[model samples]
Target: MSPPGATRGQPAARSRRRAARVAAVAAGLLLALLLCEALGWPFLRGPVERAAARATASVVSIEAPFRVRFVFSPQLQAGRIVVAAAHGMALPHLVDAHALRADWRWGDIRRWRDGAPLRLEALRARTLDARLQRLADGRASWQLGQRRAPPAGEAALPRFGLLTLDEGHIEIDDHALALRATVDLSGSEGEGGRGIEARARGQYRGHDLDLRAHATAALPLLDESEQAPALPVRLEGKVGQVVLAFDGRAAALLTGRRLDGTLRMQGPSLAAVGAPLGLALPATPAFELVGRLAHDAGVWHLVAESATVGSSRLTGDFRYDGTREPGRLDGRLGGERLALADLGPAVGAPGTAAAPPPPGAPPPRVLPQREFDLPQLRGMDAEVQVAIAELDFGTEALAPVRQLRARVRLDDAVLRLEALSGVVGGGRVDGWSALDARQTPARWSVDLNFDRVAIDQWIRALRRGGAGDDPRRALLTGVLEGRLVLAGRGRSTAQILGSADGDGRLLLRRGTVSHLLTEAAGIDLAQALGVLVRGDEALPLRCARLEFGVEDGLVVPRVAVIDNRDSTVFVDGRASLADETLALRAQVRPKDFSVLSLRTPVLIGGHFSRPQVGLQASRLVGRAAAAIALGVLAAPLAALLPFVDPGSGDGPDPCTAAPRSAAAAAASAPRR
Candidate 1:
């Protein structure tokens, strides 16, 4: 019984010893594996290449010295690494690097495998070359592998803490944008700072391009942490005649973070500069601008220290909020002077220096016919207040506007100019104008009122006779008040006017006309000759009025009268906005007896470009007989009593009291 118990214990002891040896072997094997892993597992290179090729759908290769290690983190080092372009791509290779090294946390690697972006703690490359291309159809060479649906929510961007580039060459050809460029890059590190600098030369659209840029150390730039410091940057570039420069600092550049900087730009025209960038900026004369630029919370801000376009100069602060649907632009801009001609291009008018028509092209139209770019209005919403001390009309015929102020708003394809008020020629004008681009042809409307405008200052007469005449001498003196309301639908200013249907009335009070002109109006040959010999003098006018109705672009006079002490002049006419033609007739009724008078109607007929004025031939043929009849007896002066002034109190306002039927009858009367 005792021997049996001893043998059993001995077998148990042997089993325990065997277990210990097996544990020792296992520990040695584990130790060897860990050592190999830390030293870099070169054997993983083949598998890595295969995995990379599968992931990118491209050819991937690695020369000797390629290795990967996974201990506390994932580490990669490669020699002569190359990644060929994806299948169906034209380029041979997308990336070729003589040396590359990268390191990332194991937790990041796990997250990357779970559909998260790959983030590296550090990256370094030497002698790297990259070529990128985007086709017209939107296919991009960098977008390797099969297309996949975008992840829900905002997609995360690839990030890194540190990036070091020794020597690199990058070439980009974006067919869709018509951009092509080649950049030579070099890593710079010294007391000045550590960063990458580049020089680029290429073409964008059809313009030649050259650019140079320098940035802060790559470490801060690559850091995605919120605590990362701002990265300093500097850039200068030129495309054709356009020049641009910037000195800036950015935080979280890859994540839409804040950016603050100074920017400067100059170019032959805003249109030329915006063309390459696909911006619908208005065509304008040469321009230069300096501003402070900033971006924060999806909004971009610019405070222009000085901006000059043509002869116009302005300073303003503007902000663009991209967080809103269709975006929004808000700002207030004010200046001492604003050239109307420089602003023409914004409303489809020619720029300051309009291009000459082609050799065989027809003469330019009197009105601007270029169609408004309506679709651009729908791209963004804007509310801007503009105030200018002076608005130059760029013509001596029209007086410059003073204290011009307006609020411009664009929303949902409708552009409105509201609260518009200005002073011109000692008069105040208030108006509201709107352009509704939602319609195909676009609808336009305007309601304007003028108060107490000095006629002499508003309508300047061309000086003659070698400046002998006083330039300040008024050809006509009056204070004019008017109202014009019009509405039409068209794609251009000309087209809108051609289709306009509106009415207007103008009243002139306390006025005077040239004595010689008043005498001629009455067809008093002796009086006119005598007035001319005595030198023309101001003849007091009781009242003057002009009222018109527009129907389908045809303007017909409703009331046109000029009453003076000597005579009452009546005008009847129809002006065709559609054809730009004029047909008018004026008849003069003398208030007093005349030694010689030919009561013939004056006729005016012609196209806008060439006008003709003459006395009615039929009336002229019997003028002598008519003069004899009038000379024999004073024609009943009672017929014109309604137009004669009472010589006291506020006389009858011709603008309101003139007979509409008389104007119509005069217009429809027989030519004779």
Candidate 2:
């Protein structure tokens, strides 16, 4: 206090002593914290409960024996714990446990905080009850706190190294799946190894469900050792008339990380089986399928060994990847034969298992009217190639298609069929088609071409005469070629066709027509009588050409003509696709001389379902007057000449000029 230097030294010493005291107190507090941690810190139960309740947004309570310790890893034990549901949840409680214990690794906790899955070292529970629920709007009762973004990797589930449970009950109610189930679960440990078994009773998609499952204990699932065995699992379940069974082995259950199994299912309809899984499977007749199923990461593979739907059979390998933003399906499917009728349900045709319409409802329409599920198409992408040796149309009028192949692709609600080729009626068809479901009402377009088709084979005679008659007699014989380009917008096939606008043309070369029909058209009484007395014969044709233009579902003939050795027939017609009606007139111009002839036109009219044919009354009246006046004023020969033709068939071949005109018109037309 007296000297200046002494005062500065005294202040420094006091500061050093104060700092030493602070260090000692810090050391003592750390030592006490270590001791408490080793003893599980039972006295901190209230604080722990409060922290858990705040974290879960639920009411958490624990009875005596509650304890927690955190040195490097965390350990928890409690007696008679109860966790109430989060606010706004329908259920009152999420979990009620008579006894519960859990342990976790320090590294796993840190990894979980950094977006990795949390792994538990051990879990043991007794008399536990847990309830889980999911609403249609995607709210889940078990979801705690705010929702977080999904992890970057596979959405992995928590794993456990060792698990023991007794008298456990689990209930699940999922509105999206229309499923409500209650399960009784138990676990066992023995020399044979740990195992888990469960029995469930529920209702799924309006069907009563009964299920049983068994699997190797959850402990091995957490083991990453090379020597660990794959968990063996077996599940058998039935929902109403549908039966499902699976026997498999997996690296981890319910994760689809790695799985190998045999899956077998049989149901009244495939639609029913897919209902609870939210798959838009096509409606089908009673069916059964057995396949080798495997999964890795988020992809599923199925190699169908045998699949039968009604009388149809198919086998293929299919791959489905659900990890992408929009799921994708890729597959190559083929079979020896496929019945078109069996696939009717896919295009809205009524299957054999379909229920009849109500008594008061109108009969089903001829064209398919079921609207497409456009939203479902946006949920997935696909590229599938199909090939079939034979495709049966299920009708005697149309021959079976052979060597059918097509590549189908779907992306962003747009469906396209490319590289489409098939052989039918001894003809080749090549084309491409597309449906843009992204557009309202869905726009559709098709450009198809038919080449080198045998017309006679497609138009067979309905009746047969004696053995002496030719069995191959047909209405017409020719090599035909045609093209069609059309576009429309609608939700169903009928509506699409009703609004279609297009142009088309047909060409038949080196063909023949019915001799009797040709003679009757020209009213060649002598030749017609002679042909009728004998048998009908085939008359060689020069050529036939038909071209049409369509506008707003109305088709009008631009050129319709048939040229043969004896006569040239001209056809004028208009067909209404909207009302399904027909109106036509045919006039025959005789190319040869005939004594008795009536130059009258033929009229054809009616609905597509019922057509009427008769002579044109106005034309017949004019012809009659001309004949009568000629007979009165001049000789009978002169009178007959007015009604007969004096050979006008020697003109320039119209067939030669028609093709050139058609080509020019096509070239000048605007392209879509």
lDDT of each: 0.74, 0.72
Candidate 2 global Cα RMSD: 9.8
Q: Mind giving the per-residue lDDT tens digits that candidate 1 earns over 1-672?
A: 579889889989998999888888888888877877866878888998998787667788988788787776677899888888644578878878888987889787677666666568876788878776666665655555535423222223345666668888877786755768787777853345367787778887778889777875543432334555677877688977789887899764323356689989999787776565433456777889999988877688889899998999888888888778887879988888888888787767777556777787654556677888777777778898988889888876667889999998988889999999999768899999999999988999999999988777766652223223443345567889999999988988888988998889888898787767777865668778888787877768788888888877777888889887767788887777777777888888776666556666888887665566888877676654544565556565433322232222234445567446535743673331
Output candidate 1 Cα RMSD.
6.8
- lDDT string for model 2 (598-647, tens) is 76777777666467788878777887888789888997766676666565
Worst 10 residues of 1 by lDDT: 641-650
Give the C-alpha miss distance for residue 189 in model 1, angstroms: 6.3
Clash pairs for candidate 2? none
- Candidate 1, TM-score vs. the true structure? 0.78
lDDT for model 2, on a 0 to 1 scale? Answer: 0.72
Model 1: lDDT of residue 442? 96
